[model samples]
Target: MDKITIQNLEVYANHGVFPEETALGQKFLVCAELWTEIRTAGRTDDLEYSINYGTVCQEITRFMKEHTSRLIEAVAEQLAEYLLQTLPLLKGITLEIKKPWAPVGLPLDTVSVKIERCWHRAYVAFGSNMGDRRSHIDSGIQVLRDDPAIRVGSISDMIVTEPYGGVEQEDFLNGCLELETLLTPMELLAVLQKAEQKENRERLVHWGPRTLDMDLLFYDDEVLEEPELAVPHPEIPKRRFVLEPLSQIAPYKMHPVLKKRVKELLEELSDRE
Candidate 1:
């Protein structure tokens, strides 16, 4: 990835924990690294093909002057998110917000907060057993496509599968979807939950029938074992419904923990059955 670096662009703003700090402003410095592919811009000498550093700097100036937050941490966070969301050519950012006048008693020049933020690739499993199954799946895809930060990359053919948890319900229409997104694993989970809620999904019973079921299968090869969520989906290897569809889209995707390709796992499961 190519880079654009902006360092110590200074601004005076009211951001502090003390009341006096709010009444009387202080100096703030911002440094940012914008990441993207600049090949097209370099080849054509086209400003449109690249992120304009001048425009980005001015936008940072505007944001610093407009918003008043108590902490530089908050300022850095919101500003980073804002830039990433607004700039179309930008793929990632490393941002630092420095407060020169922070009331630290020590003889420090400045106190600052820095962070890195970027996009991620994720796989999602979609299923519906209720009314208009195909419609539900299609609508979910449309919703994802509508989101600016999420790009629907590829889709697998829908397959019919019986309920997995021994529940007395209708067969589900299942499939897999590939996405490129700027969302974290937890944020992606929230988005999936919201999409399922839109289709009136309910969580009354464990693996019970529902209108829609959207599960986060993998997130950039991340392996997480949180209480509410698990990446690599935990049971994906054992479930033919998930493996079959996921194999169609990402047969070569490697499991983070198992260290095996999806195709290998699918073959293993098939042999067992």
Candidate 2:
């Protein structure tokens, strides 16, 4: 990915924990690296094809001056979100909020918080077996779409399927959704849980009937194994309910670990059944 680096842009802003810092104002520096495609701009020498660093610098200064936050962490996080939303061409942002001359009395260089935030593609599968199944699924989709950081892409048609895990339950309406997000895997999982809770999802039983069930099937071809999250979902190939809809939108999308396409997995699963 191409990048545009803007380093140590000076800004006079009122931001700090101490009242004196905000009242007296202080010098804060911001650095940003915008990830984008600048090849067209380079080839054509056209301003329209590229992001304007001059404009970004101005926006950063204005944003810093306008907002007063106690922590530079908040400042950096908000600034990253702001830039990502404001700059349509940017796929990601590496931001640093630098605070020099602290009141801590300790001799130090600079205190800053740096973060790398980027848009990541994720495939999520959802199902509902309880009341108003379609409504639950649709509401989940709407929640993701409405979030500022999430871009809901292809959504497969809802297909009714028998429940899994040997649990006797109502038929489930299953489907898959594609999303582009700036949230990390765990953060995205929290968001998904929020959507599920909104629909009154329950965990009374394993693979039990619920208002909504959502799983992260894949994330940017990433194979993640964490305490709370797993990418290239552990059961993507075994569950027809998941692969069927997933195949509809991302047939050729490969499983990073398995090295198999969605279509191929769906086919193999079908052959077994």
lDDT of 2: 0.91
- Candidate 2 weakest ten by summed lDDT: 221-230
Checking candidate 2 for backbone clashes, the offending pairs are none
lDDT by residue for model 1 over 57-136, one digit each (tens)? Answer: 99999998899899888988888878887888888999999888779788988888999988788999999999999988
Task: Give stretches of model 2 more than 4 Å off.
Answer: 106-109
Model 2 C-alpha lDDT per residue in residues 1-273, reported as the tens digit of each score? 999999999999999999999999999888888999999999999989999999999999999899889998998988898888778899998999889977889999889999998889999999998989988999988889888989999999999999899999899999999999988888899999999999988899988899999899988977789988878789888999999999999999998988889999999999999
lDDT of the structure predicted as candidate 1: 0.90
TM-score of each: 0.86, 0.92
lDDT of 2 at 271: 96
